[model samples]
Target: MRATTTLFSLSLLLAVSARNTYRSVLTDCLNTASVPILLTSTTGWADEIEPYNLRFTPAPSVVAIPRTQAEVQSAVKCAHANKIRVSVKGGGHSYGAYGLSGTLVLDMAEFQTVNLDQTTKIATVGAGVRLGNMANKLFSLGKRGVPHGTCEGVGIGGHATLGGFGLDSRLWGLTVDTISSVTAVLANGTAVTASASQNKELFWALRGAGPGFAVVTSFKLKTFAAPAVNINWSYTYSFPTPAAAATAFQIAQTWGQQSAPKELGYGIMLFPGNAFIVRGVYYGAKAKYDALIAPLLAKLKTAHGGVEPTKSVKTLGWIDSLTDLAGAALATPARGYDAHDTFYAKSIVTAESAPLSFEALTALFTYLYTVVPPSSAQWMIIANLYGGPGSVINSLPASTDPSSTSSYAHRTAGYVFQLYAYTANSLPPFDADIIPLVEGMVTAMGEEAADLPAYAPYADPELGQAEAQVRYWGDGVARLKVIKAQVDPMGILYNPQGF
Candidate 1:
């Protein structure tokens, strides 16, 4: 017994000594650098480390906030030398915690800078810049804008790389499509600029598969003149039965068959109370918007049978439109990053090739109304019209388009259906069952559409890694794997669903 106890004591001492040695090395390396390296026990640790989605509270050993490109390179090199895994946190909005799990986290929040060149109509944005701030800044500077995400808190890094969609996505392309160049740090801690003329292959991968290959520092993106006016319209139709709700969905799908005007952005939301809400924004004047939607509204009313809808139309400036798109609370400048509540979300892209049938819509509505548990927090289904007439998404065939070389493969999808369940609890007890339920809905939708694709940014953890990759990348997976091998040959940068 004494011998065994001594052996255990010696092992414990060795482990402690090794851990202390590692800490010393890491501290020494960071102290010599220019950025701030925060320890887990530091006072500001919680504030700096908290992700947008409270569900993922990562307890990384250290968090480094680099303010410059050189500092980012140094931090990556230091992490590599110390044999510590590094994860980059931009806006900290990765739903699946893709930005958190690592021995060291490179928090890019301090690198928030948006510089616009009026002559070129291009914006050079830091990876950490949030969409709302960027949009406001651009509008103030020169009434210029780039396609970005709807959520104000979403960061440029993940959104642009994965696929950034917004109210203007149909008119302009995705945010990634607007990127003219990218500045990133490779696995070997080498800083490189990727653009059409420089590191072409790296640029192709950086635009879409950035997280899987390198740490992006900044992006030079093309900007467009902001629209003068944005007209918002909404109509809510309450259904008494699942059949009525399903019929409304069918009519909406039929309307979707005809290419929507490029100037208009449209979507639908289904709430727990058997309510289907149709909401849209027209970039032009209110009169033109009315002329475009009037016929569709008539057809929808006819399809809705006896249901009467509460409808409203309002026109606002571009900035106000952005505020309207994101909830009023989120758009509030005072609302801090920590204000966002914990949430679980899943999404699937529905293509025009295989639309959701009426039977499938009814079944989905039934499941949502009956099987899904009701919680104090909000949960609902959102279907966004991601593709239509003016969408440059599929303008060129995937085989020939340079933009298609990136891993975002759902360009052909007409709409993206998202299932979001929000809660205050970071670790909800019902997560186990809830996750599967959400995945089941996606599975059913995929089956209905003969195996359609999923959006990568949503990043569903419930979908097993292999299946998630197939869903996220589709045929692009093969090319992504080849590039992954070439860039991150050491397999340094990685995430569960990454290349």
Candidate 2:
């Protein structure tokens, strides 16, 4: 017994010694990487690691802000040499805070450079550029645009790579589909551009499962013409009963599947009070929008005993429309963006063929109205329209071979539901009810229970690694793993839910 105990003690000592050796190596590398690096317990360390989702507070050992491509290569090389797990934070908007979860963080803040080719209509956006800033700059450059989330603070790198969608997505396709190529540094510190022609396999994995593979520096995206006349419209209704709300929701589902046009971007936002709003923007002329939407409005009023909605509509220019949607000015400062919130979110993508049953819809409304906390807590359910006959999002395959398509898992998704709950307080260590309430509400929707897929960007931090891998990537997980082995065999670019 004494000998066995001595052997165990020796093994433990050896493990500690090995850790100390690598840590020493890592320290030297960060100091020499020629960039501002925040180390744990240093002056600005705590603030640097505070992520957008206050629910998570990851204590990364180092936060390296690389200014140039060469600096990025050096930081990644050091992490690889020392066998430290790495994460890249583009905007730090990850719902699970995975962007801040790694022991060594590559904060992509200083990599903000945007260049556009006018003739080809392609924009080379830096990974650090936020969505709203990208839209504003592209508009200023050549009245050009790309599909992206409405959240102004979301970073372009993670958003575009992880299946970005927005009011204009059903019209232009996802932000991933707009990508032509990407410049990335691999685990081995080699910078390469992946596209249809070069580094083809890496391109496929990076579109949907990007964060796990490498440190992406910039994205080469296909741009579109900003419409001259954009219309912002909304209809708010207060339903007397949950059944009434379900009836209106079902009407939206039917119209979205059959009658809605690609130019018409819309969704039903449900509040905790059981009141809801069917709101969106139209990309084309106002007269045409009125003609196209009149039928749906008529149908909505006819359902649930002639429910009438309060309406609001206005015309705006390109930048004006985008700014309104963003709810803030569509421009970012050079640095120091600290927008954050304390919230829990769960998302599911429902397919075109498998629409939600009326029973499930009714239950979802019932639970929200009766079971959710009072008006004090803030919560919202956004059922965004993603699939229709005119939408390119549904036309593509999930991911296939022989040139290999994008790995975005929900090409057939008709609606992506974001069930979110937050406390009155902005800082986290939130009240206990937030998680159960959000999860239970999502469960009542019956989409995931029906085996519909999950969205990778709005990841649930609570899920186990294996379960999240399948839900986010499905069968594509195998190909992603294969690519990871080929590029990141050391598992350098990793998050908790990543392969």
Candidate 3:
């Protein structure tokens, strides 16, 4: 079996050639390119690499910092020719082995340039550029971008590849919808550019296929006129039961459909604390926004005394809004820990599945809290609807990872529920500590909890069985395998999730 061979190769490599394998590969790849490469053998390299969670670690191999698209192409081709595995890293923010495990890591650290085309309202961003940096750059030019979440350090390459969701997803759409083009290095070491007119299938695959399929060197995205000051406020309230939380969450969703405008976006967070946090943004007049949310506000006030009609609002430049959302000032980079990620993700909002999913979430959160240390524990259970013109899939065809996959036998009704877990501790018997908690939650939920589709970005190798694969991807797996055969027949660019 392929797994058996991989395990054997790993054992042999560690026993017979452990000391010099990675260094030799790095040296050969750098020599072939005949260019300067950054080599970090110890502390400095370890220090700069920080994942969102502590479970993932950068591979032991030395990383190369590429500044230009040409450099990226050369790096990929050289690695391919040398039989070395290649992974493209942007900001090193991905919380799994995709960014860290094996082979050569093509660090995009030097690829941090954002060029704006004011004439056409398009921005050409380097793959290595972080969203936080891009937002700041666009602010200087008086432009704004589609929503892609609040993480200031996430790179467009990874986020865009996974169907970026953010405040604007409910309004302007996901990050992928605004993508005009991508210049990427393929598995065969060939450099290619994809758009509607060019390599279109590859273009479609790249949007939500995750980074291993190709190494994105640059992304061209459409931009909009920057808002002077965006207003945001959140109301948090406690509920007595899972049914109560689910009903209230559904009410908010109904309200969004009836009254929220294209310029407004909001999120509902249902937590185990028997609490629901309703947070929203307004791109227009405050009075207009207030009027639209009044009904929901009134319902909340009547049901929950803690619910207040008063709102705390802040006004800042478009870039400032990103920083505020990132909680950058409050959150410092984590240190001395191991972090990893897996998702109990779903994509539909059917009435039958929603109730069961809601009940399952309570158990899931309780399980995580019991295992993951509180100081080091952080989880984001995000539920957002995507249907309006502002929805990520509104402009693009379905099939994007975060978008619906018609290939699925079970129909999707255009909604996304993302269960994110973060921890800063690395205890002994890591698997024993975390696996039981996660597996137990899944077992407790049983068959009624289907809502998410496959995760191209957060692939879990442990779940390699047929049932697990089907549960994660359904028919999408079949489609991806076909694409993988076409694009990476040699299987050189190997990752747990990729073909």
Candidate topping TM-score:
2
- Reference-based TM-score, model 2: 0.94
Sorted by lDDT (best first), the order is 2, 1, 3
TM-score of each: 0.92, 0.94, 0.80
Q: Please, what are the lDDT tens digits per residue for candidate 1 over residues 1-499?
A: 9999999999999997987787668778887986688886788887877767666677777788888888888888887787777788888788887888767788887777789998998998988888888898888889998987788888888899888877688778789889988899987789998887788777777766678688999999899999898987899988767777788887776665465766788888877677789887889988888888887788778767755589978798888888888875333231256655567778878886666888888877777667655355556788888776766665534522555445567767878888877662644434445555565555554467436677888887767877887887777677778888888776666666886
- Give the alpha carbon lDDT tens digit for every residue of 1-499 in model 2: 9999999999999997986677668878877877668767588677778888887878777788888888889988999998899898888899988888887899998877888898999999998999888988899899999988888889987898888988888889889999999999999899999998889899998988888787899999999999988999998887778788888899888788787788888888998666688989999988999999898888788864586788988799988998898888878763667788889888877888877777888888888888846335688889889987688787776585454469888877788888888877767668668888888886887654445678998888877888888888888888888998999888888878986
* Candidate 1 vs candidate 3, TM-score winner: 1
Indicate the residue-level lDDT of 483 in model 3: 69
lDDT of 3 by residue, 458-479 (tens): 4444455454446444556677
lDDT of each: 0.77, 0.84, 0.61
Q: RMSD (Cα, Å) of candidate 1? A: 2.8
Error in Å for residue 435 of model 3? 4.5
Q: After superposing candidate 1, which stretches have Cα over 4 Å from the reference?
A: 1-20, 329-336, 372-377, 399-405, 424-431, 443-446
In model 2, the worst 10-residue window by lDDT is 396-405
The CA lDDT at 96 in model 3 is: 57
